[model samples]
Target: MLRFLIIAIGAPLFLMAMPAHGFARLTIDADSQYRYAQSRLDSGAVDEAVAEFNRFIHFFPADPRVPQARFQTGVAHFRAGRYQAAAAIFNQQTVGFAGSPLDNQAFFMLSRSHARQGMIEQAIVDLHNLEALSSSTDVIDQVRYELGWLHVDQGRWNAADQAFNRISPDNRDRFQVANLKQSLALSGAIPFKHPTTAGFLSIVPGGGQLYTSRYQDAATAFLINAGLIWAAWESFDNEQYALGSMISFVGFGFYAGNIYGAVSSAHKYNRDQINAYRERLNQHRQISLSLAPSPKGAALCLTISF
Candidate 1:
């Protein structure tokens, strides 16, 4: 009686699980499944596309298209701004699918993922790794171009110029790189105000702020210092010696602060100009990679407009 009760209780649970197990085993056309996932991705339904691609990968793990599906999944995540997820997928593709046709692409995408998340130092390290491993002229040029932009973002102007200079003369982006180099050359003309000069000029109580083009702050500093000095002089003229001394002490504090603030404003002005120049240098920077098959073999084609 006990054995019969146990079998009856287990039978329904086993039956309920069987259909799901069997459905996973059902024969499906791998191409059609991959196409469905691709269609979802193409329609801009990123979340649904991720789900469908995951489904295809789950059902057709052995299909040749599985690698491409995985790559597309990473692309979908990247497009959705889910950079960490995309990085993981691309990183895994580089390792798990070693020697596969998409290896270089996976590595590049991994670096891109890191870059998008502001992990710039890590991204640079990854790009250096990619550059060292790649033998293709086109791929190397593309990597250097990206490296240049990364350096520009970090304010490493000399490093950026070096990277851009490494691109071959025959490459299509040479003109664009020349334009970038021209921009870098103009960086010196961005109207830098020396902090020391600002401090020295502040002896006149707002001269430094004027030098830095902070008109309103210059006016305010001038008024405050002038008022304090006038108060001290008036107190001394009235024969209030103690009050005059106190006023002079207060005026000195304001005068010293004016000098410090002027120096700080000069530094800030320089930073603002550098930041604006960096933005200009970065305006046209974009990199894309596509795999193309030739009669001899497959190669990665990297294209950059600037």
Candidate 2:
């Protein structure tokens, strides 16, 4: 009789475990979606890949894979050169899941997005945060290098120099070393006043790089500027630079280019300090909590009044 009773009681318990196997079905569904989407992505069927992922997100809203999908969506946007959209998505993820395992990865993507938009400071901040938060020292070192280079792009010599100096010798990335040398060279050129020319070049992208003695950057800016000026001169004269109008325009380009270099260098330096703080926050796992009993006012009640 006892054996019979045990079997009768166990029957429902065994039956109840059947639905628990549903996760396997869900796994198949998600896998199928991922594979289909990957194929679309590979074949350059961007719209199809996006639609498939969107469907998966709708079905598995609470799944851990949501972040990964969101990140992939953001990547697609980035690859498509939709940087503003990509930055928005990545930034949302970084803030939305602050302590999640995906946080570091999100920040890494954010840095890339900001860079694409030419928002160098914000990108540098994200890079520093990624360096601090991730477990890999190698990743941190690589970000440190990138952050330093972004600063160089904006013409911040002092900050760039300090950032380079702080790099761990063991993790010395050669690419970063070369950029640091470049930043240093530009920094050496920033302190003279050619205000009017500087102001003009500063307003134009890539002008500062040339002003601070970054030859490649200067050539790029100079050529573009010269072309524009030549076009304007050509509008009025057949002989471009031989004309007074063309000569003045040519002179202005050189002047603007030089001034832009100094200011850009200075701006980059200030951002490095902001980036360092962000890195520090990630390096340490910080929390503030008081040790007290679980119930509210437990500490007060336990203590007797004197």
Candidate 3:
């Protein structure tokens, strides 16, 4: 009876333990794979991390960790500067993991990828969609700030102002917004030479170049035109009609070219000044966004500096 009791109890225990061991082994394998992939990413082994993430997704589609894995795959692409690929991955996650906590982050990453690729319109559209879809104030504020900066890059001053205005005054980005507005205003106020006026002034040879403040060019133009005119007149007085005609034609061509060149020069001068001003403004008006820790796992944060 004692032997029978021991066998009976040990048999059931063995049966339960066998299945538990199998389940534990499976769990360990899955977790190990996930951690390995994470470590690859942390070590900047982007390709290896992406491949590992793909394998994990394929093997454990239903796992709760799958969404994070998918997101990390996109991040790996982003870190490698494969922006289009990153965008594709992030965009898919937005739909594939709908309602997941990583949804907003995926959207933001998609927008940033587009922006990095110089697809400003697409970036703006993505940001707008993020604003509409996310209820998080932090996400919305971050999107607005991004929109503002994009507008500033495109020289859409009014649009930038409007975008910034939408952000609450109490938000930390308000000071940055003010600085951006001031920079835009100052850039717009930079004086530029009027092309039409420069052309008018060119009626007197070299006048247009002078008006553009190119004194050396103006002097060169005046000297060349005066010499050519004098040469043509002297040729005509000496009864060298053919030579005179040739010289006169050349002088007239130079005179007309001078006028056109001055107009173009003035326009170019204005453009150069504007570009320089923009460069200076850019140095002082950079805004960036990144992920930050939050009570709910992660959130977007905007950084601005001069």
Candidate 4:
């Protein structure tokens, strides 16, 4: 009877100890994995970090840090330039973790990833959603500013103006908006060369190039066509009909090419001027927003504004 009682008591104690020991081991493993993943991410081993995060998420689905793991995975994809994948992950987080603290951040990252991929429409949609969902005034202002900048990038000046107008005059971004307005006005006033006029001027061999301010090209075109035409005339006068025909054919080609080249150059010149102006505008815009690495060291923060 004594041996039977001891066996029964020990069996239950052993069963209890087994589960406790297993739980302890699992916790230790989870902690180690989390730390290792974070270290990998800090070291810029994005792929390895992503893999470790995946492993942790798979094994510790109920862990409180799972949300952070998912977010870090997306950030890893973003750092690797896998924008579509990053966007997908963030999009999922936005929906799956709705009302969670990470939701707003995920939504913002989703928009950024979309923007990086040149999916402007999708980015704008996400930004609008962020605006609707966020109660933060700063977040709303950032959304509006981003929307305006997107319109600027697409050269939709009217749309950009509309977006900027949404910002209150008292807002800190007022100066930036004013600068953008000035840039838009300047762009409108740029005197672009007419391609038709350029082509018409090219009737005089290299006159079109001269009109486009391509002085060296105009000189080169004029000399080449003039020399070829003179050669053709001399050959014909000497009764070398075949040689004269060849020279005439070559001369005509160069003459026609000059006309076409002049038209293209004029159009390109206009584009270049516009692009240069826009580049300066972009530089000024960048000065208005400050970007720095976030506390996580995995993403950037655009919080401080000049």
For TM-score, the strongest prediction is 4
Model 4, span 1-306: residue lDDT tens: 999999999998999899768565535477888889978988999999999999989998888778778888998998898999999999988885354346766877798799889898999999899888877666567678878877877767778778877776666465477777777777677768889999999988789999999999999988998899899999999999999999999899999999999999899999887777667667656523423222344333332211
Q: What is the TM-score of each predicted model, taking all chains together? A: 0.75, 0.48, 0.69, 0.76
Query: Candidate 1 has what TM-score?
Result: 0.75
Per-candidate total of colliding backbone pairs:
0, 6, 0, 0
Number of the predicted model whose lDDT against the real structure is largest: 1
Worst 10 residues of 3 by lDDT: 292-301
What is the overall TM-score of model 2 with all chains considered together? 0.48
Candidate 4's C-alpha runs over 4 A off are 1-32, 96-101, 132-135, 286-306
**Which scores better on lDDT, 1 or 2?**
1
Residue runs of model 1 more than 4 Å from their true location after superposition:
1-33, 96-101, 172-175, 235-257, 283-289, 292-306
- The residue-by-residue lDDT of candidate 1 on 1-306, one tens digit each, is 999999999999999999988567646687777778778888989898899888888987887667777888998998898999999998888774343347777877888899889999989988887788778787778788888888988888889889988998877464388788888887667888999999999999999999999999999999999998999999999999999999999999999999999999999998999988887887757656568332245545564533
Task: Pull out the clashing pairs in model 3.
Answer: none
Q: How well does model 4 score by local distance difference test? A: 0.80
What is each predicted model's overall lDDT from 0 to 1?
A: 0.83, 0.61, 0.81, 0.80
For each of the candidates, the C-alpha root-mean-square deviation to the true structure, in angstroms, is 6.3, 17.4, 9.9, 7.4
Q: State the displacement of the C-alpha of residue 173, model 2, in Å, after optimal TM-score superposition.
A: 4.4
Model 3 bad stretches (over 4 Å): 1-82, 96-101, 116-118, 172-175, 248-253, 283-289, 292-306
